[model samples]
Target: MPQRLELAPPAFNRRKILIHTAAAGALAAGVGVPRWARAQSGPMRIVVGYPPGGGTDRAARLVADRLQQLLKRTVIVENRVGAGGRLAAQQLVNTPPDQTVLLLANPAVMSVSPLIYKDLKYDVQKDYVPVAAVTDYDFGVAVGSALPVKEVQHMLAWIRANPTKANAGVPGTGSLPHFFSLMLSYMAQVNIEVVGYRGSAPLITDLIGGQIPLAFDTLDSLLPQHEGGKLRILATSGLKRSPFSPTVPTFKEQGLPLSAVGWNTFFAPSTTPRATVELLSKAVFQIMSEPETRAKFTAAKMVPVAMTQAQTEASFKAFNTQWTPVIRRSGFKPES
Candidate 1:
């Protein structure tokens, strides 16, 4: 079991008062403050692994805004983009456990990358503590105007018929979309090739320009075009239809027997105090439960679901168990 930090009500109240008093005095004196002291006085940071404007970054900013209001402390989002989010994960591992630094991480940084990368810098299970799961999203299998098929069945048939044009677009190599597409090919018994792009925006741009026939990306990334009639989403990688797009069917509904749900979760250094983890987790749960917050996430085609700390850890482990073998069997190796 994870360690739990408990404090007496009276002692906690007294400590809070003392800390605030000391912080005020320190500011008045204008003396140089230590990092640990500044942690208690400075604005907290929520690190994002992707560039601004992406779903992950947007989600982090949303939570940061709310968390600042709830905690009565300034919270900022810092983007440490690169290495498919591994850079941010590594930074979090090296960060001090002062309750001021947190990370909004994707499953790839926590579960998939460790299994695939030969020299992963950190062990997620050891270096980080799961605070709360913010939101969940499913990938959508979409087609450009260049493709004749309008649905998953038709798309599969088309792929089988035109083996030479069986290329599928993904955000990047070794990404969840890549693995999910490979799983689809394995189960559907087709020879669909994957064409990886640096990110989803370029892939979607090419798809719209008829440069790519098929692409798989977060529902949020493709929903606008799908709704605008510029693209057709055949199926989503969810157990059920997405709330944002109820008319769209899931892969399971289309007889694909696959469900790949990705989530953005909050994490702190593993050495963080248990009390701090519990406090932040409670705040996150409250933030996610807000009707306005839920609406915003749904607008972005993400489902707002908050899990307890224990539940979050279990979910992480379950995802690792489910995907590690599938990724290994796919026999994909990243370029060194």
Candidate 2:
């Protein structure tokens, strides 16, 4: 896995502030700044924290396609997969700020990585700037259809009854899946063991193979299997029933309203220009609003959402505060 992006303080705006003190002063600067300087000149690489074949990767590809068209430049997605997505986050923050690289930015790196690693090389708040982000479906908790369990209560009963055989698989130890599964254990009042995999792909594989009978992961990963009759969804981790599966129950329906939607977002290096971020964000939202894009994401059990850079940043801030107490109590601490 790539390391998390190291945080560098935002460049002081004093210079730009002074230069744009008045409309005439701003006009002088605006006229002098070349169109080429304002426009992105090269290919834009959309980096993902995980490898291809999963939700983040697939969504990145979707956004990449639209970005390429909208920007009139090549848009590429590269998977940096590792260290709970810290690798990709770190890579983006370290890249030059020429609007050349962006991240498919997973919570594993942005929200959770800061809570887990002792020395997370990057500071999500300071080192990376949101470009655009999607609030995809929440992680779903399910069991093999072969299991007798049907709901959260039943699953808890089954786990408690067959303590030896009951276990759940998550994407990675400190990733969002792991955090949610851990929360499930707390809610269920049982010590269901959590097993981590390289990514959602292998985790789903083991799930179907029955190497693991229970698991909690992104709906993007479990949708195909669940819909195909490979696994039975016990409870979706999201607060509401996903539009993709009206029949599937949510943790909230079962009376656990604490669960909320998860997200996969994109961000640029901290040094990247604000204008570039706005352009990228606009392109992403435009793509997400398209029926084809929404349909495709719905099919994958991942919802298509697009938020402006400021909106994305605000959302992340709220999520950070929302989960802080819960995570801190779990004995996890942010990197110093």
Candidate 3:
């Protein structure tokens, strides 16, 4: 055959080919950019009010890691610590509802602070919508050697007999542990003078050295000392015994009919689109349900909970209702 003449192939339009492929992808992936991917165009952040290494911060970091993988976006944990978490809460209030920032807050910031702080800058209900509940933890009723009380009943009797010496220390003034200790006093019909410490370390030091006769703090904070036999945890403020301290009795189990369960929940600015909130909420639920997450929470003495938006809100509301009367009855004055 004389030279076989073959028509030259049409020149490839790289841009046009890319455009077609992308359009085909869009159609295959369902009409437009996925809602999640669109919302995640920018980096996401989880804001924690407490310093790093604390329970809330740790939980936020864990979630950030998993969310970065699931959403294929950068995620970071920001510690906006000040004013016992109020500063962070206020920051969230002013933050745009772009779904880039979310607050990992405890009951102190979410439910108690608003009730106790007269000059609170943000109304939680109006400023933020609960996205997910990450963990549930309870307070520990610990007694020092100076008090010499082994049980809640014995502690109550001691408080009654030594009313002038009945001082209970808490990690912070307006913290749930403070109010929880007061609730114990109110229920037992004994007077207890509540004192606030800077954080758990000093509170724990005082508890061990008899600087304070009794103290209440998170079960996680008190467990080490209690387990070391430096102090004793008379009771825990949960409906059931803590998994970490199965030997310890609950306040209700000890006939107090009182419980103080605290949770670390995530909240986004109220103006965030419902679709964004739902997407983030689903991701959180998935992360919390993972066995690795549960193991980490358990190791930290916190019960892992993966509550949806409505359930988280309801839990927060019920917590407010449960503690409002006790806080009011304790006569805790608001800080300016």
lDDT of each: 0.77, 0.68, 0.77
**Runs off by more than 4 Å, candidate 3:** 1-33, 36-39, 334-336
**Candidate 2, which ten residues in sequence have the lowest lDDT sum?**
1-10
Q: Mind giving the per-residue lDDT tens digits that candidate 2 earns over 43-90?
A: 778888886887678888877886676566777788887865787777
Model 1: per-residue lDDT, tens digit, 1-336? 112212111111211222233244323222223344335867889999999998889999989998887677799999999988899888777676655788899888887888778899898878999888887778889999899686788998999889998889999988888887876776677787899999888999999899999998888888898899988999988666777888999987887676767888998888787777877777776667666876787676667775666766766766666667668777788896
RMSD of each: 11.4, 9.6, 19.2
Pairs with steric clashes in candidate 3:
none
The CA root-mean-square deviation of candidate 2, after full C-alpha superposition on the true structure, stands at 9.6
Count of backbone clashes, every candidate in sequence: 0, 10, 0
* TM-score, cand. 2 vs. native: 0.76
lDDT per residue for candidate 3 within 65-169, as digits (tens), equals 878887777898999999888899898776766557889998888888887788889999899998988877878889988888778888887887888898999
TM-score of each: 0.82, 0.76, 0.85
Off by more than 4 A, model 1: 1-39
